[model samples]
Target chain A: MEKPVVDQAEALRKRAASRRRRRILLYVAAVLAAFYSFWPVMVMGLEGYNIDLGVIIAGEAFKTTTLYIGGLPVNVKAIIPTAYYYLQDLGLEAYPRLVANTLIVAGLSIGLSLAVGIPVAYVLARIEVRGRSLISYLLLALRTMSQFVVIVPLYIAYSRLGLYDTFTGIALAEQLIILAVVVWMLRGFFSDIPRDIYEAATVFGKNEWQVFRRVVFPMVIPGVVVTTMFALVLLWNEFLIADTLTGVATRTAMVGVWEGMSINQLSFNALAWDSLNAAGFLAYIPAIVVVLLIRRYLARGFSLGAAR
Target chain B: MGAETRQGRRARESRRWYLLFIPLFVVVGFVEIYPLIESLYISLTNLNGGASLSNYVTMVTTPTFWNALNISLLYSLSSTILAVLIGIGLTFILTQELKGKGIFEAIYILPLAAAPIVVGVLYSPSSVWDDIQQFFHFILHQPYFNELTPSFYFPVMFFSDAWEWSPLIMLVALSIVNSASKEVYEAAELHGASALQKFRMVTLPAVFRSPVMQFVVVLRFIDAMRAFEVPLAWTNWLGYTNTLGSPVDTISLYLYKLLYSSSLGFPLGVVSAVAVSLFVVTLVGALVLLRLMKAVGG
Candidate 1:
């Protein structure tokens, strides 16, 4: 009634073969997606080589070098590490300082937000706070508000207060961006604790602060750590606030790279492309390392704790 | 009587926790809300010392302002839709039983770490575009598309955006898929549901059922609406008849131009007006999209 046994076996084999084929296809697609995701980074990472080579060739050692293909002026610049080192010697002296500015600003902002945000999140999550929903919505709205809306006024205020171009000034302005993220993500983390645990801690005659310190805070340490690193990456990559607020001494590496790009593109004597690209790559090293390390937490972080 | 007093005391105790919110409220209020209010006030006043609606009038009458709005809408919609679709496709591929899944996931998330400006810098015409042009010119004997046309910059912007943001949606959707019970898939297969049917009725529903997906779409759309760094960085800054409004200038870039462009004399009132209008538009767009999602989900 089910058909011949041999025929049934053949049908199962065919289905298995198709399944294998489909699996192969999906693997190929995933590989392609990975490539697509980091393609620009790879390009940016390699671009320095081209510029460095150009620098070397432009020097006295390679003045006669001219590349042509089919009588067309086609200069195929190759990767030269020595040229990058040379450019690094000349053009990248300020890179270390810019990177330091970025780290200091990002660290200060993260510390400020976390110290401030963790408590607010705790209160909202566990306490019977009034207007919790209103506060929540306000934070969400703040997240979507354009940076320029506030930057205009802040620019005026910072200039008048002599806070313009200072690290503290830049960090203060950045709270508009990072604070909402901290509160939202940590609120999600705090809310994940069971009501029973909170109640049980309260039953032990512990005050709210005591219970939070001994119990819930320790429980969400992992989440807090992840959130800190995540905020660091966001603050590190932030351009508008830092670009607008910072001057020469306080310019974060991101703004530095941006200025480098502008200068390279506009100026007749371009800054070595290799040096700029290298600076660009170096600017995001912490971000790249942190993101990869926290890949497991990415779903939770990206969803702002909407997902388990 | 004792219970009533205890209840009141507990309520008061909990109210004290609200003080914990003060630090955040103070910082955000000073830096964000105050500036926002100041911006609104500035928008309604004139730089020459008189309050007027002239800033709004000037903004609304500008052709470039209208052009920027159109570009923002188109860019936000098309790029977000494309990214979400690609994200969904990626979720399916990634959920497959494959070797090296971890490594691939790590690679996929790398773009999210790159700043928007970095993406723009990397993919600028002088760099990546030139490479592509050279490839075609050498291998296919095609003419180089060297003109800084909309045809070139817009696609690069969209692609860079997708490259950066698609991973966000993927991570959200992938978590949903991973969290789904194995029993559901087994049950579907037992019912002789084909692969397509399983994906349609099972995977798709599981992901779309979450409000997170809607939030992500809104996030992507609103962020794209404020597209600045990518377009700003993509342009050859001092070339081609523009310093700010170039091959593509969304509303934010236009505001930057208004604020910083020497020809405009750094018109703060006009810039504030444009920013206010942009914020209103973004909020309305987000609310409408959220409402649409709710309707669809219902």
Candidate 2:
């Protein structure tokens, strides 16, 4: 009996210890995963900031200058430049042109998408159209088709039409992605409006256009905002289309930065790491800020179409 | 007579509503359908513009094309599987009672906002790659840390893609998991089911059985299969030219090479053939995935 009791106690202790061990393992795994996720961003931010700071405080180094802070020697020598200096270093003509082009392309793409997408979404949502499911499936397939697949033909067509190396060309290519997403998202939003609301509007003798313009459109404003924000971010980060479609004249910021980096790579010693990082940082900030500013909408928007 | 007129007017109104679809159809048709048709047509012709099936035959016979297809399959399948697994694991841990989970969630998603080129730059030898290398070499004392090897190339590419995309999967999985009814779990507990048993019987099916989950999977797979930017940036940064049989030469990149940098001059016809073929493959794959998911879910 004593031997059996001892054996039982040992078993219980081992089980408890193993349970504790498992919990520790779980905690460790979580922390490690989080670290892995976050460290890249942290590194990029740090490198980018360091470079930007160095550029901003460009000044002659006072050789042999040192300062003591709590028994630690610190070099108080290197001086950074002003924002103007850094901007000049970032290529005043080219950088500004790239920025303008990026903005224009993104703006035009968004405008065109909204113009095209809103009406289609309304029709799909409110009107009882034949082969509605077929249309939706077609849109899904188009969305799934990689941009690269279409890009080949697009390049040839753009070149043929003299749309190559132009802002409109890039915008048109970007619209391929933007329009589909907008239509899909807005359809979901529009469909969510209770059928009774449409019936009530029709009962009030409101025409189809008026019902859409006055009633359905107003109700889907939140969805519109969410879709717009997401679309803007996507358009801003687009590289493949921009890289292919645009030449020197219409090169967007993404393409410009890439080319600049590659050019800099050839002369590694004289490479403007600061300028490169600054450009990268500049490129990255808008999307991050936009996303964070409208994070709530994004969270809701992401869950809206699919989850429903 | 008044009710008949109202019904006629409603019919007219619905017909007019169809007009609203015209602009969208025109735009999409011009951009998507036209290009697709143009690609198909181009693929069926020779460089001399003569109609022929020679382009498709050439693509089939080309070793580079086969190599690219193999690499694409390897990269997409491996990356998708790993990312989904990691995403599932992260979702499981995240859904548990943990402190500061929100911060982790936010951090996990930060990569999604970054451009692929930016990601490549961050991981390239000129930047944090060296730091990562040193961490392995000096800290871990594992010398001979060569990142140029195929082993390094595959994993780095996989990790980079996964880093950007896994968060999306996590979000989707979490949404599904959280939305699962608590009553099921309570019932399982009442039945004296163990934690693992309850999770297997309840949580797994709850998350995986959703149609939305399958949609997300197919979408991610398509994206993975066509991955270009990250690999391009990495190889560009390293000045590494991807030849035939190169591990990193995804089909899209291979197509790009043919279009822009082919030694036999611009093989537009062959590239177009490859594009059309890939498009068909992706569509069929997506359909098959949908069917499989439906079968499993049911």
Name the best candidate (by DockQ).
1
Model 2 docking tier (incorrect/acceptable/medium/high): acceptable
Chain A, model 2: TM:
0.74
For A157-275, candidate 1 gives per-residue lDDT tens digits of: 99999999998888888887788878877887888799999999989999777899999999999889989888888888889999889998799988888887777777633335656
Model 2's chain B TM-score? 0.87
lDDT of 2 by residue, A112-202 (tens): 8888889888887776777665666566666667775688888889989999988777888887777777887787788889999999999
| CA RMSD of all predictions | 4.7, 5.9
Tell me the lDDT of model 2 at B210.
77
Q: What's model 2's overall lDDT? A: 0.73
Error of 2 at A180 (Å): 1.1
TM per candidate, chain B: 0.89, 0.87
Give i-RMS (Å) per prediction: 3.9, 4.9
DockQ agreement of candidate 2 with the native complex: 0.41
| For model 1 chain B, the run of ten residues with the poorest summed lDDT | B289-298
The CA lDDT at A299 in model 2 is 33
* Model 1 quality (TM-score): 0.90
| lDDT by residue (tens digit), candidate 1, B223-279 | 888778876775454263245445477888777766666676547788899999888
Error of 2 at B45 (Å): 1.5
